[model samples]
Target: MLKLFILLSKSKFGHPTVMFRLISRLMASNKPVLANTPVPVNKSKKRPAWSMYPKLHDKVLEKLKENQLNHTFNPKDEEHSALKTYDTNIMGRFRCYNDECSSPGWGSKVVAITIREFSGNRYNARVYHQRCRECEKVGRLIINKSSYVDRVTYRIKKWNGVNMERPKWEEYSGPPHDRKLCEGCRLGRCKKGKSDDE
Candidate 1:
């Protein structure tokens, strides 16, 4: 075995030096390389469970859809406090991250919105999307129900399916422009039509 090891080491079979060290260790130790060692535990910390998130998400979506039937309000309107806040804070505020467009990082425009009202006339807007005026890409925006007077403050939970900074409005940027994901752009006659050359 020692002669064979030496012969192998001097040949192309031992091209890798680590193999020689391992083989030498095996020969010198006179025992199995894996013997008696404790199995390693993957001590990765478990994330806190959001068990109710799915049900709550479905409920919110259902409520938003139901409210959409009668709760249509122009995002550009500033008469209603809730709608006004939505307009100023969310609509035409987010910057698009799409590089395909001629002007990436340009602020997006509100294309669709849904609102749900609560006690004391407080409102929560969900399923709202902002479309880039340049490339016509869409990004989802969510507004939380805080208080009637304080509803003006919004936290962006997600943008285009990504977790956002959640605090700063100016930091709110969106996913890459995708016309296919935008209904107005997909169906044609987007707020701003594509250039004639394309």
Candidate 2:
């Protein structure tokens, strides 16, 4: 808690927490200081349990790194299966992680995680990716023909098809196409067309 307050205060005010920490280290190491007026004490704040795990994130990062090395299952994980990878998409649970999926039902989504492997066994990364909501699977690769280029590649990504309840200048326009197609984009295109004529 005290350390977090110090960190927060130090970050906000550009105060020297590192110097203070160094002074703390020096005091701990029995370094002598001049007997002048002592350093002013800073107020400390208590941090929540999740934030105060004492290098928990570092430990997780270390384990993730070790998993990259040796390519072996963790002996410490006695309970988990030999294959420990997991994802909502692989299990075919495309629903959102939110709890309130029942009352209004869920907007269907295809959610999955992707792991990129490397040869040197140093930096492996796991990324959680959503199967495009519209396509209901991982995104698609599209190829467009360009007269100038041999091949042009584009990616079609699935995005949530939610309708946002915002007012728009589309009041002057007719019925809309796909609802997620923003009114702002349509209005901007129309405004540009009119301005070009004027």
Candidate 3:
């Protein structure tokens, strides 16, 4: 039997049925291909990158500790003013979820916060959006928004007043990215113009 198996394996142009049987028998034996090879042990599951932002917030807060604002949070401020107030000075980490993009994320203050306004002069819901820095750097040729992926978990790393708390990884529970309201989305770089021939 051993001689027949070795002959079959050594045959250059062996029958398909004999080759298949030899391969199947080898796999079924459960013997290591290499001598004294270590068996692979199961590794501990790791936490997702997004889930670790609370700890990252600590490190990022150290960078943004001094850039505090005393101005009250307002929903009706002018768009530019609001963006400056909420996004300009702070540090934000964002991940890119676009297809074929391998960016883990980037840390920048390019966040856009929207405070929704309801009827009867009511204002609520702080919606946050962030752009992928890698995508922005790459610069796409077609007319498309700058890969503004959502659901960036944020925390009040430092609280100075009422109406806020040190929430643990508060995932953004707001509306989707609005291309019309996005400055990056409105830029000419993201748009394609018609040619004279057209």
| Top TM-score prediction, candidate number | 3
| Prediction 2 global C-alpha lDDT | 0.26
lDDT of each: 0.36, 0.26, 0.33
User: Comparing candidate 1 with candidate 2, which one achieves the higher TM-score?
Assistant: 1
Q: Give lDDT for model 3.
A: 0.33
Q: How far is candidate 1 from the true structure (C-alpha RMSD, Å)?
A: 17.3
Give the 10-residue window scoring lowest on summed lDDT in candidate 3: 188-197
Q: Taking the tens digit of each residue's C-alpha lDDT, what string does model 3 give over 15-124?
A: 55535554565568776444233323224333121111122333333433444522222344334432212221122455444432445555443333333223342222
Judge candidate 2 at residue 52 and give its lDDT.
Answer: 12
Candidate 2 worst ten-residue window by lDDT: 148-157
Off by over 4 Å in 2: 1-69, 72-89, 94-111, 122-198
Q: Which predicted model would earn the best lDDT?
A: 1
Per-candidate TM-score against the hidden true structure:
0.23, 0.17, 0.25
RMSD of each: 17.3, 21.5, 16.6
Error of 1 at 187 (Å): 12
lDDT of 1 at 189: 29
Candidate 1 Cα misplacement greater than 4 A, ranges: 1-92, 107-113, 117-124, 139-198
